[model samples]
Target chain A: MSTKNSEAGEGKERAGDVIVETVARLMVPFIQLFALYVIIHGAGGPGGGFQGGVIFGASFVLLVIAFGIVNAGDRFPEGANTAFMSLGVYIYAGVGLLCIIFSLGAAQFLNYGFIPLTTHFEENRALGMDLVEIGIGITVMAVVTSIFFNLAWKREPEEGGEEE
Target chain B: MIPSLDLVLLFLIVAIAIAAITVRDLLSAIMLLCAYSFLMAVIWVEMHAVDVAFTEAAVGAGASTAFLIAALSRTTRWEKK
Candidate 1:
């Protein structure tokens, strides 16, 4: 019983301080917005899909740090994360395939100009690049979050036969 | 961009790298590595490799630090003598 009490106390401490929680709450949305901006502006700037995605993932990490992993994990369900990982890959590959198919196989894979989204070839290329960036961003964000979740997840003491 | 700033950042990075390797506590090593990554990002930017700098800051400093800490949680905090 004393051990159980101490464990509960430990859990409470891990919940983190009120200042951290408030700051995280205030900062999360801005971080996400900046992530989108990075993704969109990547073509002409330093930021891109991977960097934006990492930033997005970092926001989730911040939440986990401020509120504990279990709380953050519960909010981002594992199933959704898995779906997102696959979905991003599909979006990425699908665009490449679309270029080939729409151009009657004359264009190589990922030839964004071959995509018919816009009447102008340059516009089509730009739009396709943006889509691919978004896809990569999604995959990377899901992957980073998933890795953190798996690494940090702790089995219940009874189930794991006590860690120590 | 300034030569002095670049020298200072590089010096700090090398010091942190050595400290990370010598630190007895795994947590401190991870934090030092994070700082090293951040400084490296600054160096990349100074060299005009803004894209590489962005990636270094995001993945090297931000994501990898969190990952190392999470991995550390599943293991011991102190280095085994």
Candidate 2:
């Protein structure tokens, strides 16, 4: 029991100075919030889905730097990461397909205005673009995080015998 | 987009690129590359391509730097002659 407790605690061990850990913990939420703003504001400004997603992934990277990879990985499990990737693609494709189905094949793929989300055609286009951007943001975030985790994770030689 | 400032940035970018290539220390090279990415992003903004600048800042400076550092961890810090 004691060993199990220690192992569990090990995952949350602080990697460096207390100040670094504190700042990371405090800053993660704000970074994520900014990421959302970037995604939403992309339609009218300099930011976009890819940039926002990267910023979001960077927050997780910051946490991994301050805390430990194991801690971050545990919080964002491999299963969930995979799911997010697929879900984002599904949302994007589904929106396009919905546009086609609703328009009776009259509209082209990704014709955002075809979807009857709102009364005005322009509003529907705008909303559809936002949805597509959101889907892109989600996928980019998951992909970036997944890449970092794969690159940074260290496997124990004794446990796996895959030291290369 | 001051002419002198643009010239200065371009010069600095060239110098940093050379330095990054010449530096034997892998870590130092990585840092130099990160600086290069950031300066390039600024140049993009100066040219009024804010979207490209944003992408450069996020992917080039931020993500790629982390990736290089992570890749570096699995190898020797210094390049062998």
Off by over 4 Å in 2: A1-12, A158-164
Over A1-164, each residue of candidate 2 has an lDDT whose tens digit, in order, gives: 33432443334455467898899999999999999999999988999888999999988888887787776777988899999999989989999999999889686789999899989999999999899989999999999999998887665546547544
Classified by CAPRI criteria, candidate 2 counts as medium
Give the per-residue lDDT of model 1 (tens digit) for A56-101.
Answer: 9999988887887556667989899999999999999999999989
lDDT value, residue A7 of candidate 1: 47
Compute each candidate's TM-score over C-alphas. Answer: 0.90, 0.91
- Runs off by more than 4 Å, candidate 1: A1-14, A157-164
TM-score for candidate 2: 0.91
